[model samples]
Target chain A: MVKDDMANLMKKIPIESVTLGIGDVARATGVAQSKLRYWESKGYIKNHAVTDKSNRKFTYKTVLQVQLIKSFLADGYTLTSAVARAQKRAIYLDALRSFFEDRFAQMDVADHTATIDLGPFDPTPSKHLMAKRTDQQWRFYLATPES
Target chain B: MVKDDMANLMKKIPIESVTLGIGDVARATGVAQSKLRYWESKGYIKNHAVTDKSNRKFTYKTVLQVQLIKSFLADGYTLTSAVARAQKRAIYLDALRSFFEDRFAQMDVADHTATIDLGPFDPTPSKHLMAKRTDQQWRFYLATPES
Candidate 1:
C-alpha cells in the first residue's frame, strides 16, 4: 500500500475523475452559474461530458481557472482578456506542479526543523538534493543516499 | 564590480525602467497593434504613461503578458480567459523568480561538472547547501564553508 501510494504520488493526479457540478464550481469560484455557462459556450472554460446535457460537471482545474479569470476580471482586464490571461497561467501552474511531482522525495521533521529531500540530481546517481527549513529559512544541499 | 553584480543578482530585477514600444511588443508577441490598443483602452493591459498620447509604450512585463495572452488564445481559450490565465501565471513566475533570487548562491564549473551553491542552511550557520551535476544527474549534499 505504501508503494502504491508512492507510485500514485509520482504520477499526475487524474483530474478527470475529480469533478464538481456547475453549482459547486460557481460557489467555489464565486462566479455565477450563468457566467460559467457563458464562458464554457465561448470556450473560455471546459466541463466534463456527462450523459445528461443539463448535468454540467467541471474538474478542479477548471475551478481554479474560473477563480483566476474572476480575479483578473476584478483587476480591470476585460472579460475576453481575462480569460486569455487565465489560460496562460495554467501553463505556469502546470510547470510548478510538474516540478513538485518530479523532484519532491521525502520530508522529515525533527526538533521543529524540517528536512525536505528533493530526490536525485540529474545524471548523478550518487547524489540527491535536499533542503532544510529552520525558522522560515531554507538551506539547500547535496547528500549521498547513506547520509 | 563583482560584489555589485552579486548584490544585483540577489535582488529582483527592476522591471519598470525596461520599457518597449507597442510596435515592438506586438512584433514580439505576434499580437496586432490595433488589438493591443483595444486591450489597453479596455484596461486589459497597462502601458507606461507617455507624454505624447500618440506614442504608446509598454513595459517588458507587458510584453510577456501579451505573449502569454496570445498563446492562450491559440490554445482555444477565449480572449478574456486567456488574459486571466496569464495573470495567474504571473504569480507563479514571480514565485519561481523569487526562489532563484533567494536560494541561488553561486555556480562553479570544472572538469565538465557543475556545482550549484544554494546558500547556507537555516539555523545551522555551519552548514550550506550545494548540488553537483555530472552527466545530467544532480546530487545534493551539505558541506561546511571550508569544504
Candidate 2:
C-alpha cells in the first residue's frame, strides 16, 4: 500500500519545465496539428525532436507563434504577409521596450504627483507616446526632437 | 455636340462624398466582397445604407476601418479583439494629435536646434515619453512634474 501511494503521488506531479508535444501544443493553443506542421515546414516555427519519428515537441514560444499565425489567418491575411507582420510585430515591440526603458530612467514620483520630460517632438516619426494618469486621464506626445 | 460633350464630362467626374458600394469597397481595399459582407453581418462593420433588399452602401470611414481591421487581423488578433484594438487605435491616434498640439505650442526652433519643455517626469503614470534625437540617439523621460 505504501509503494502504491508513492507511485500515485509521483504520477500526480507534473514536470514544471515541460517541452510540449505536438498534440499538447495544439490543444493549448486551439490550433490544428496539421497547420502547426505546415508552419514548421515553412520555417515559421521550429519543432523540438522527442524521438526517432512520430513524437515531436515544441516550446511554449512556438505554441504562441502558432496561435498568432492562426489568428492572422482568420483575420484574412495571406500566409506570407502574416509571417512578415509577425516579425514586424517583434521589432515594434523591441522599439517600444527601448523607448520605455530610456524614459523610465527619467521618471520622478512622490505621493500622487509624477512628472516627465519629453526631449523633443518629431514630425516624421511613425510611433508616438500615450501618457496615462492614475486618475484615468491620458495624453499623447511625439517622440522626435529637432536637431 | 458641345452640350453632349459637357454632359459626358459631367458624367466622368466622381463626387467626392459618394458612398461606396460593396464591390467598390472590395476593389478599393483588396478585401473580398464575401468577407466584407461577413464582417458586416458579424457587427465588425456597419453599412451606410441597406438600399432596397440587396444593395448595400458603405461610408468612406468604413473603407478605412476595413483596411485597419484587415491589418489587425493579419497581426494575429481575434475578430472581437481586432475590433476593440482598432477602436483603441483611433483613440490613441486622437491622443497623439492632442499631445503634439499642446507640445507644438511650446516648441522653439532655430537652425539645427530645437527646444521643448515637457516639464517633469512621473513614475506612477502608465504612459511615459521617449525622446529620440534625429542623429540616431534616443532617451526616455517621465512626462509629469512633481507637486
Candidate 3:
C-alpha cells in the first residue's frame, strides 16, 4: 500500500504535453543540433530538462523559443534584443505562454472586429503584428479604442 | 578660334570630382572593400558608374548609401524588411533627422505661447495626427505641432 501511494503521487506531478529531444528540435527548426548547443552556450535558450545522462530533452516550449531566436537573429537584432528584455526572456515557450495568450486574445479582438460594422477607425490589428525569428522581429498592433 | 572656344568649354565642364572610387569609399565609411562588395552582391545598394575601368570607381553617393545600409542592418532591420517594396531601402537613421526636426519646430511654438501665457487647449491639435511609415515596422512618438 505504501509503495502504491508513492507511485500515485509521482504520476500526479504536472508534465508538459510536448517533449522533444535535441534531434527533433533540430529537424523542426532547421538549425543544426550543434548550433542549438551553441545558442544554449550563448544563453539564448536551454532545453526543458537536463536529465539527459546521455542527451538533453527539450520541450515544445523551448522549441518555439528557439524558433523566435532564429527569426530574430536573421532579422539583425543584436543578441541582447534577440534575448528580449531581461525580465521577459524566458528559457521555455511555456514561460512565454501568458504573453502569447495575451497576443491571441488581441487576435481574437481583431477577428471580431473584422466582421462588425466597427467603422473606419476600427482597424484590424492581425495584419500588423508579424512574428519572426532570425533576429527578434515583432510587429504588433497597438489596440486603439473604437472611435 | 572655334577649336579654342571648344577647349575652353571642355575645361569649364566641371572636372568630375575624381568620381570618388572604391578606395575612397573604404576610407570614408571605414567599411572594408570586401564587405562593401558583399553588400553590393546582397543587393543592399548599387553603384551606377564605375569608371577607371580596371580599378573600378564609385561615386560619393554610392559610398554614403553603403554606410546607410550598414547602419540599418546593424540596427535590426531585416534585409527583407529593409528592401521590401523598394529597389533600395532608405536608412532608418534618416527618420531620426525628421523626428528631431519636427520636435525643434514644436519647441519654438511652445516657447512663444509660454511667454504670452495662453491656455493649454487654445493652441493644440485635435486628435494627434501622426505621419508614419505604413509598411515598415513603426516606432511610436508623441508628435507635437511645430510652432
Note the Cα lDDT for every prediction shown: 0.60, 0.48, 0.38
Choose the strongest candidate by DockQ: 1
Sorted into a CAPRI-style docking class, model 3 comes out as incorrect
lDDT (tens digit, per residue) of candidate 1 on A69-123: 8878989999999988767655433333444444556655444455656777544
**Per-residue alpha-carbon lDDT of model 3 for A1-147, expressed as tens digits?**
001111121122212423445765665566789988887777667655535564565544465566666666788987668767321323222222222222222111121121111111213432232211112211122334443
Of candidates 3 and 2, the better by lDDT: 2
lDDT for A8 in candidate 3 is: 21
Off by over 4 Å in 1: A1-147, B1-13, B50-54, B109-114, B122-125, B133-139
In candidate 3, how many Å is residue A50 off? Answer: 5.1
Docking class of 2: incorrect
Off by over 4 Å in 2: A1-18, A50-54, A91-147, B1-140, B143-147
For this target, which candidate reaches the highest lDDT against the unseen true structure?
1
How displaced is residue B113 in candidate 2, in Å?
24
Q: Candidates ranked by DockQ, best first?
A: 1, 2, 3
Cα error, residue A147 of model 1, in Å, equals: 24
Candidate 3 chain B weakest lDDT stretch, 10 residues: B108-117
Error of 2 at A114 (Å): 19
